[model samples]
Target chain A: MSNRREIEREAEHVLRELSKHLEEIELEETYHVIDAESLRADSSPELRRGFREAALSIAPRRDGAHYVAEAGTWV
Target chain B: MSRQALGEAEENLARRFEEIERRDREINSFIELNPHAQEEARRAEKLGGRLAGMTVAVKSNINVRGLRATCASKTLENYVAPYDAVVVERLRREGAVILGMTNMDEFACGSSGESSYFGPTENPSAKGRIPGGSSSGSAAAVAAGFADAALGSDTGGSIRNPASHCGVVGVKPTYGLVPRHGLIDLAMSLDQIGPIARDVRTAALLLEVIAGSSREASMLDVEPQPYSQRLSADLSGIKVGFAKEYEEVTSPEILGVVKRALRRLEAQGAELVEVELPNLEKALPTYYLIVFVEFFSATRRYDGRRYGYRIEEVCGEEVLRRIMLGSYISQKEYAGRYYRRALQFRSLIRRELLQALEEVDVLAGPTTPKLPHRLGERLTPLEMYAYDLLTVPANLAGIPAGVVPAGRVNGIPVGLQVQAKPLQEQVMLNVMLAAEGRA
Candidate 1:
């Protein structure tokens, strides 16, 4: 097997072992639910603008009003 | 109160700045000292609110306008915060001087403070050992007296772990009790921006200011209380719970310190109770699974085009591991077996804790399962993950938890952790105050 493939297999084995310990934890009626609507409230325009400017100022590459992003994966 | 007193305060503040600069050269606790700190301290002295005359160092993950919120990663090496995080704003409003940003594990991923792109933060209390992380520098700054108090975000023991190892006070408020507006996310569901201080009262004051309803972010519906005023050393009639699971996992030396501290509480009239949390052992896996998924989702914005470097390209080994694991688990093929299962287990752990709390007023345990490993120790990933074993359950349960200096083992600090039900911070603080010998 390729070295990369061997490492991948090892990782899988480790993850499997970790998951095995949690297997006996029986899931009851509960689900991890988040309220999407409550998280959607609008901020004041002044606050929004301040956040926008701060975010925009840090962008490494900017074109006019848009942040220019690389199109393909570098890795 | 007088002109001479004000002048003296200013003189003291200048000396503190000099001390921080000189000492931090060796400790590496601070990432950047606030250039405007002197002016801000002068202003705070004049303004005189609840936190006036207090100097606060913020963890790098929490934003302070005009300072770099690097999260100690090369990905955000140059990313300056555009605005104050809600907690920072609250502190500024109440006349607290923002000292500067402190270092942390790269993207808050490591148990030890050694993974920062800037450099590792040496433990101030335990020389030649790691300051527990990712709130490493926050706790260290307080330990080294560089700041009166500091702000650190706890996802799973980030604040409390360092607080324990460094012999300071750290509080992780019940989830949503503190607003998360300015914090860069590690795991939003579990992350809480909280206070680290030399004493419980200062931590309570910081928590009071930062924990409230905010227009900028979704917060818990509960009203913030005057936690500082509510603190008392009296633990009379309070039932302190201990889980066998916690005792089972903690190292003998640290556990001995924690038990003796619990006896101190008992001396002050608190009753001890044994509580069963059958699902406690499963919390670590549950926490990491949830963290991995949420962290991967949160890092999608750092795609190299918009802000910082692509995270996967610039992040440390631990970070890359989580991102890859999260990506793999999130795939349609494996999501159910891992991520979904983890969520369900999270709920089980939460239920177990809530049930345990119903039988007792608070739970006590060692903050971390073991003493901090020596700096530069070659620890496996599992060894690093073990540090969160005792700390993660509170985050999972969305409860208030804190660490108080229990005593020392071999001159290394050990913390006695006290946890209370959701939104019951005052009760937890009282127990911690008793642990601090204020009783």
Candidate 2:
């Protein structure tokens, strides 16, 4: 688990580096919290897409009055 | 003598107390076992009700009024619940004495229950093995006999995994069947408060107290069932579907045990059939992506604000990871990409489950693929995500699921999962009780 180091070059974005060091697929890996200021001035559509996908998965979807979200999988 | 049943129960409680004192030191199954449980037991006996003298341990996530709901995380440390969680309030209404709040993975994140700031909970069934978690303490509390039953939350497999590994009964009620108002949210859409007990009948009793509508908080958005109190044991002609997707994901040993249990159900008169839940294979990644994003949003309130703890400062490893992922995913730019795709997949899975249920009354399988791991055994987030293979469908479909002790594999107990359609707990429990040979 690489702790965020804000040294000569500060970085933003949760370092996807934790994705390395290969562990068992069912195991829990460390959550990365980056400095708020480190966020990229601009994000790629790919990054945006991943986050959007994740968000819609948990976000409540409402249609007028009824909560129409029967889509996301339960954890 | 009905009143005196309390006295006898107190005596039983005393004996159990001595045992908990002796065994608890080794298992650490309890975060807090009320020192006055016996007195409360006697009082409950005098109250004279269905659960009058029964002892219940609440998961740290469920509020017990004066007791703290830490969600087993340091984030909520020192935060005693100002009011009772809906289930706790219901338990109190029924004359049930809460033993104490049990430990869990912080913020209900880990499957191993190792992410607690207090300490890792040990598996009660097989020594040196992890009590499957998120609901580690809740299941272990019952497995260790520290409490008669326990209320636990299952976002994914928290209750079922621990119950499976600990040789106990754990059930995740259909979402909305039980209110969530007082319970802390991990992922509001997915988090469900449930019961962990030694047997299915007792679990039903606890569910009775906790399930239903409150004036303000209806755990289920709609009343799925009027009462989950009286689950029938009759599965004579019920149809049980075995999901084809589970074959590639389940362990042979686990499946072998589950198959025997299914055969037992068949012998008891259930019709076994093969069913398809095509999207279930994608449910793990889909569930994780959703949990990460939502959990992050839920924790945002804890940024050293009105909430008790700053997660970045005090939350455990799994939680922080999720917060980051959740926060990342919820950002404006990424709104529809990853989160939407997962949601799309989520919809597909739910559609598949509903279609499968149309053909069968319930589904059955091994709750978890692998057996328990030792404390500190490193596993990747994806691997950790795999444990919910069998459980995600229930959550995704917002249905009730029961995990009973099927038997053991290499000394570790395995859970046989029985799931049913939304709000159909009786049908689910009937299938499960028959399957577990509880009749």
Candidate 3:
């Protein structure tokens, strides 16, 4: 737990220094967001099948056609 | 070239494979050798493209079909890539034989190569010293002649850092200039997959092949240029910029070596101009803030559900540190204080670099602030992060940067970094060619 705290402290120090520098610079609030839309072409049937097989090849848990994933918990 | 010449080239490649098997036991540069490399070389000889008969090493973070994309971590120890990365696909089409996947700093987290789970890569050039990371093996492989060239991705100096330490040329193309479709990236916005090779022309040729528009990659609108044919040693009218901030951070020994290289460029008729970047100190902190957030987000995919082990459970200390810090910084309450501000600083630094480049063609500096430490030497995370001080601004600004062997400091090779404006790889490669001539 102490080790975790030390790491947190180190992160805090870095962030605090950055915060100070940010305050010194006077710039308008600007948002630079890259559009998240996928520009990739639709995969051909063969390509899609290859991708599915490849994905299944590495999956730790999978049924015949479905990949098994851990349930997200809100707690 | 005749059939006999082609046969000789195949024979040379066969000998290189033998050399890798023999020499890489100590260097640990390759994570795995391609079983089909000889057959691939033979196929390349018959097909004959731009890079025909040239063998290449791939950094483990980039996908090469059927090879383990481990990122030097235990988590992905068995995750074989499903398909070749766009770059690898391009290399295959251009007739370059894939040598194999090489080692790296786990999750591309460390500047020194020591953090790899497979064991640290030794500096083949410096002997017993560290090979800089996280593209450690790629550069070392080229340096030790394991491959004619190699592919390495630079987020914050990963490619050039190792290239500098290993005495080879490494390039980080403009962020959007090279596609990142299949890279397991550290920070997506900053990552650019580039070439590491024995000389400038080979690096330029590799860059020309792999850099172009791809629907798989977003924001990559820059058309690929014929970089190799444009190379010239005559720098009669080229303007090179030097920054005091870079010198202030660099050790005197490394700086002196860099200064001598600058003088050589001057003798070749290149003009050196002094430029100022007042917010240079802020770049390191800004770079880390963004990397932490992005890396944390990227690692969320490794939950042991679909592929690989849950990263947090099996990653190295540096990887976990970035993950934890990234998680903390991405919190809604703290995001504005850290991550968002870092983005604004990124813009500011980009503007500063573009402004500086207006007066000068390229900026030259020492690739690393200090020489690489000895292998297994313990350093605090901050100390390790400082190694990227001289190289991160280029990434932050999304510019093309390349490192050429400058000279030596205490028998350890130093690199002179040349950074050009975004999509100005030809200009950057030309300066690198001049430095290579001096070297």
Q: At residue B383, give the lDDT of candidate 1.
A: 77
lDDT of 2 at B87: 77
Clashing pairs in 3: none
* lDDT tens digits by residue: candidate 2, B154-255: 998888999998999999998888888888888888989899999888887778777777776745455434344556667788999998778888889888
- In candidate 1, stretches whose alpha carbon ends up further than 4 angstroms from where it belongs are A1-14, A26-75, B1-9, B332-335
TM-score of chain B of 2: 0.95
Model 1 residue A40 CA deviation (Å) reads 20
Ranking by lDDT: 3, 1, 2
Encode model 3's per-residue lDDT on B143-200: one tens digit a residue: 9998999999999999999999999999999988888989998988889899999999
Q: TM-scores for all candidates? A: 0.88, 0.83, 0.89
Q: Please state the error at residue B226 of candidate 1 in Å.
A: 1.1
Candidates 1 and 2 compared: the better one by lDDT is 1
For residues B1-439, what per-residue lDDT tens digits would candidate 1 score against the true structure?
3445544545666776888878988899999989998898788778877877678999999999999999999999999999999899999988788989999999999889999999999999999999999999999999999988999999999999999999999999999999999899999999999999999999999999989898889877767799999889888899999998877787898888888888888999999999998777789988887887899889999999977698877777778777777777778435388888887888788988999999999999889989998999988677789999989999998999999999999989999999999999999999999899431
User: What is the Cα-based lDDT of residue B59 in candidate 2?
Assistant: 87
Ranking by DockQ: 3, 1, 2
Q: Which stretches of candidate 3 lie over 4 Å from their true place?
A: A1-23, A31-75, B1-4, B332-335
lDDT of each: 0.88, 0.77, 0.89
